[model samples]
Target: MEPRQLRAIMLYEHNLGTSARQTAEKINTAFGQCTIAHSTVSYWFKSFDKGDTSCEDKPRSGRPVVFDEDLLRSHLERHPDATTRDLEKELGYDHSTIIRHLHAMGYHKIMSRWTPHALTDSERAARVTICESLLLQPHRQDFLRSIVTVDESWVHYNNKTRQAYWVLRGERAPTEPKGYWELLDEKQTINATICGEQLEKLAPEIATKRPKRLSVSLLQDNARPHTAKSVRHILEKLNWTVVPHPPYSPDIAPSDYLQIIRTHLGKELVIYDDHTYYCNVTSANGWKKYWRCTRGGGTRCCAARLHLSPDYKVMKIINEHRHPPPRFIVRNGVYTKIG
Candidate 1:
């Protein structure tokens, strides 16, 4: 029997003028177990005598209140990125105390670094309108399968910058010359026509890799070259459908690689080259897998590990390689330093 039931029995026996020892003995005989001690019975009898009938534990004392909720909330509203130690110093409270109150107030630190360009009211409305229209389409999945999202970046040569490093006590710090610029002739910007031609060649390769049929949906931002009449004509003649994208909305475009990884959730199949890596049963319950670069250890092995979901979607990557791959040597046919 529970302690509360025993207490109830003790109260009843006490009302009948039975002593604490007799009540305890009667409880033990009735239950066929010596659950309640004479001391426990006497304690409950005294509580009942004093008009206290509740069986639950009383409220504990010395509950911590290190920081004011209103003050912390107001301060965080102004500076949301403040650290726990920073808050501790500002509020003149212990670090643990500050942390406790922060958790109590339902505040957590997250990486909220902004990546998208600032959008105006009209731009935001345009994105919503375009999204709604796309959702209403009958063949959304087919459209997505055909998308060949393209973006360009300028590759620089010999652009190493100096960084701080640990040095010996007597040694002088190494230096690199700053403010050097690459010549215009050294840089080449790709236009939409060149991108379209590349897509036409790549479509067959993509089809062989992907399970679905290849339909070219060329997705690009509102760059002058991308929206050019000549580029449009070339793509249309090649049977590629150009998806309409709102200006200043890189987050909505598949070309924004970071945005896609951050927003994607649930089951997704990711293929690397011709290999399809399913989730190994050795993985934990969570949706994360750590696959090594090479199956077996070797001298020229890559330390790089791919982080993916259970269904094989690439999430994050740890590319801190200790040694170059054997293929890298074969490509150059010579050993070279990689930056």
Candidate 2:
């Protein structure tokens, strides 16, 4: 008999002190060792009396497990960030049911969200080749003059977007709906390119003098609109250089440069669904007032200057700081920092 079967038989005889028929049932329930049938188990004892030891128990049967511990562990190790929902969908199982099973099996998702991006070895190699093919152009004056910084900003109305709650003692706070954006009139602005044309319209004097005209490289995100055929053709015709900012790098943007400016300007200029002033608040017409200016087509002059002390020289420090602290020491604390 195999060692495992022999052990099973010996355990049954020693522990239960019962016959093989009841022993097999106890083994199946206690150890999930369901290979031996009642008849086979009985025969084993009878044959043992005759000194004919043998291996006869067949393996268990089922629908066939698709994922064993090794396979599941491999998947989980490769996708550490995968959520229960993600694992359930990918492995073809009911989420709650899987969750219950995983709980019983002592497994848990490491993260709340996980969306795997599948790319083959060849595909990754091809991507590397394509990325390398993006040849860097030589530095030129024209490129510098053409550069424009494109970015996005959100505007909220009613009240500034903040999280807070009104609650009674021992009572849960009122919760806000996720579809608040649809309830209110919010605008998403995609500010593209602060170019010569834009600057000219923005500040006539600066445009007239050309401000030491040299080619400026345009700064933009990886949005398709930035590299659209029409946009590219326009930039090409103007001989403007286009350069993309690193993806998700806020340090390169003016917003980060003027972080205080944004904080100070907060709800005074911007609005959102979280605005307390707008909570369950609607315009008199029950709709947001739309203006052509809000559409972001024409140029508008905003003569806001960087908040610096009068004695502070703009050019004295080539790169004063990536981010300047709020003008705490300036204006004798009487005047706030400029936007």
Candidate 3:
């Protein structure tokens, strides 16, 4: 396994109350003798004790392994739950190679929120009882035969439309439903007005789903539409409490806050030609820095990058992006981070 990946395992073992010596012995036995020294395992455990569980190399690195980033992405598309070690079976890569490329491609093991809503205690108990009953039943084969399993996937396609409608098309296909443009307009641009409306729409569903609860806690990102005056007013009128969010948080998952990895310059920004670039690679040489589009890792995966000299002057531009700029919301007038 790569040093970082192995350190991750050591952290995991520490969480499970395993001794450093035991973890070292286990890993060495599985991989080979002297694969990982007991001293190295203990050092990592000490680092974990200090609550520094970062797996990235501290700068200088090594190795000449071929860990296909595309194949790993494809594997993840098919098996989102696959662990780092699990990639070895299909990718034909060693632990170090896989870990190196995964980190290089900005991949990290994250907990997947599988269900839209969580099951209640009673619902969980009922499911447990149902599973127990099925296991105890003698006609287990019959039970299996009666159930159907399927997977959900997204399919996209495009078809050309005629420049103009023909006479053969009767009534112009009912004009494609009334207020179609209005519906599209409402969703096309989600500003303060639309965001407020969406919250109002969600109010009823929350009330219906969690009727017994006296209050609701709504957590949202620091997006402008989400925190605008109209949206805040709507939330206040609905009596929903809004959870405070960090100004520059890239993700708003509740679990993410549990392990805060504060960056040296939290999402450093660069403004050029009315366009924004985020600090993708930190400049340690005191001469040049690398910046990337705000939406580089999202569905758009914008490839745009900006190179800057030590004086913060633009050195070069790479590619183009077609996504909205990131929203920066500081609590006070202070610029905690900027270009």
Better of 2 and 3 by TM-score: 2
Encode model 2's per-residue lDDT on 1-339: one tens digit a residue: 354665556555744557777777876776567556777667667766666554445456442345454544566667644566776767766666556655555553211111112446775575456335433445445554445565433222232222322112233322222211112124632323423344335334434556676454656555565666666766776566666454433333443222211233242111111111111222475432221111122353211122222222122211111111111211111212323
Least lDDT summed over 10 consecutive residues: which range in candidate 1? 324-333
lDDT of each: 0.57, 0.41, 0.55
- The deviation in Å at residue 317 for candidate 2 is 26
lDDT at 288 for candidate 2? 24
- In angstroms, the error of model 3 at 52 is 60
TM-scores, each model vs. reference: 0.46, 0.30, 0.24
Against the correct fold, how does model 3 do in TM-score? 0.24
| TM-score, cand. 1 | 0.46
The true-versus-predicted C-alpha distance at residue 20 of model 2, in Å, is 11
- Please, what are the lDDT tens digits per residue for candidate 3 over residues 1-339? 777778888888999999999999999888899999999888888888898888776653453355567787888767655666777776777877777776676654421211222446775565566446546857556443323211111111121111211111112211111110111222365578877877788778777876666566565556688779988888889887664444433222333221112224464455442235666676566543787766646575876688877666567876343332333322222123232
Choose 1 or 3, whichever is better by TM-score: 1
Among all windows of 10 consecutive residues in model 2, the one with the lowest summed lDDT is 270-279
Each prediction's Cα RMSD? Answer: 17.4, 17.8, 27.4
- Cα displacement (angstroms), candidate 3, residue 330, comes to 29
Order of all candidates by lDDT, from best down to worst?
1, 3, 2
